[model samples]
Target: MTQTASPLPERGPTGRRTAKGSLAAKSAQRVERPAPLRQVVYDALAELIINRTLEPGQHLVEADLAEYLGVSRQPVREALQRLQTEGWVDLRPAQGAFVHMPTDEEADQLLGVRAVLETHSARLAAGCASEAHVARLWELQNAGLEALAADDGEALVTANADLHSFLTELTGNAVLAELIGLVDRRVRWYYTPIARPRGHDAWAEHAELIEAVAAHDVEKAEKIMAHHTERTRQAFHERPEAARE
Candidate 1:
């Protein structure tokens, strides 16, 4: 007599093994498509911290983060570790993680460095920017103006970042671009809270800087950019209460 054959096991939509699959099959599937849960958690936590949703000095409970992110505690722990390395979080032994509270000196130093890099970028952009690049700068300038007029703080901040990033790109220096990119996020975090108070004057300065760049006046562009960044740094220091709040 012929014996009855066992039916095939059910597979996932991607034809990967189901929970009932053999350990070897499951391991192979995980290897083929490694989960990026830690990275996802890291990005989410970073965004929250940068936007001040997770305020400086705020405690970061791994379990709470895992629950909030719909992830396991392991990924949250790994993400927090990475954030600590990047200066976004501070890990304390037995006390858990806390959002990093940047000191006044740290802010000043970083902004000063940004001023130097941006001034050089603006000068290079003035020399190398084509007509098309100038036109794009005008477009970003207009977008920033619109954001200001609408009193949209987030949009204004984003527009400001985009304009600066475009200028760096115009310089055609990959190394310079990379360095600016590294610092740009923290700069934006610092700038976001002050975006509204600084809106009108900032956009006007951007207009003048754009014009200088359009004219290919390297010295003028550098001077304007230097002044522009310095003003922002001063504004941040002047509004300490606003930044803390």
Candidate 2:
């Protein structure tokens, strides 16, 4: 005679496995939803570095970071390695990790390339931006002005980036947008230190730039963007903290 198959595990009223089920099988079925420890650590440390919470050239010890982040040294070490590869941290052979200090030349080169890309973006945006795009640009401009008035440097910087990134998207050039995005984070890091000083002037320039785009004046839009980005490049060089090697 054929034997009957064993009954499948039963579920409780709560929809979980009953006590009769194997705990190991239940545990195995549960998947952790959070990011891996290493990525979490990397993101935390990167934010600190970008926002200047972890200043450039400051030494980073794995143990201290691990303790601060409530993790073990393994994840911290992994994070630092990844940060180094991404140019956010520099790992010396025996000296450990330090925040990467961007040189003036590096800043100039990146900003120069940014200005070129963004000038073209503005030219395209002037012709292509719809009434809705111009309205969004005005909204971002007002947000930046409000942030400046409130002395919220972080919010101002975010608004500034949002406005530019939106304009870049309006360019309708995927390749150009990708190139700008590649340098965007580093540009933000550079800009954060000078956000307060640059706040008023930057937003004012944004107002004129928006007008040019809204008028669909390609030449005026391109000129205003070039000037705006160049002024930012100059402001970065003028900051005292940026003088540090």
Listed in order, each prediction's TM-score against the native is: 0.83, 0.82
Q: How many steric overlaps does candidate 2 have? A: 0
Which lDDT tens digits does candidate 1 get at residues 1-245?
Answer: 11124322232232221457486455544437544777777888888787766777777777666766776789889889999999989887876688888877988999999999999999999999999999999999999999998999888988999999999998999999999999998998888888988898899999999999999999999999999999999888876585765
Residue 9, model 1: Cα distance from true site in angstroms: 41
Q: What does candidate 2 score on TM?
A: 0.82
- In Å, residue 197's CA in model 2 sits off its true spot by 1.1
Q: For candidate 2, lDDT tens digit of each residue in 125-206? A: 9999999999999999999999999999788778889999999997789999999999998898999888999888899999
Worst 10 residues of 1 by lDDT: 8-17
- Model 1 / residue 29 / CA error / Å: 19
* lDDT of each candidate versus the true structure: 0.84, 0.84
Strongest candidate by TM-score: 1
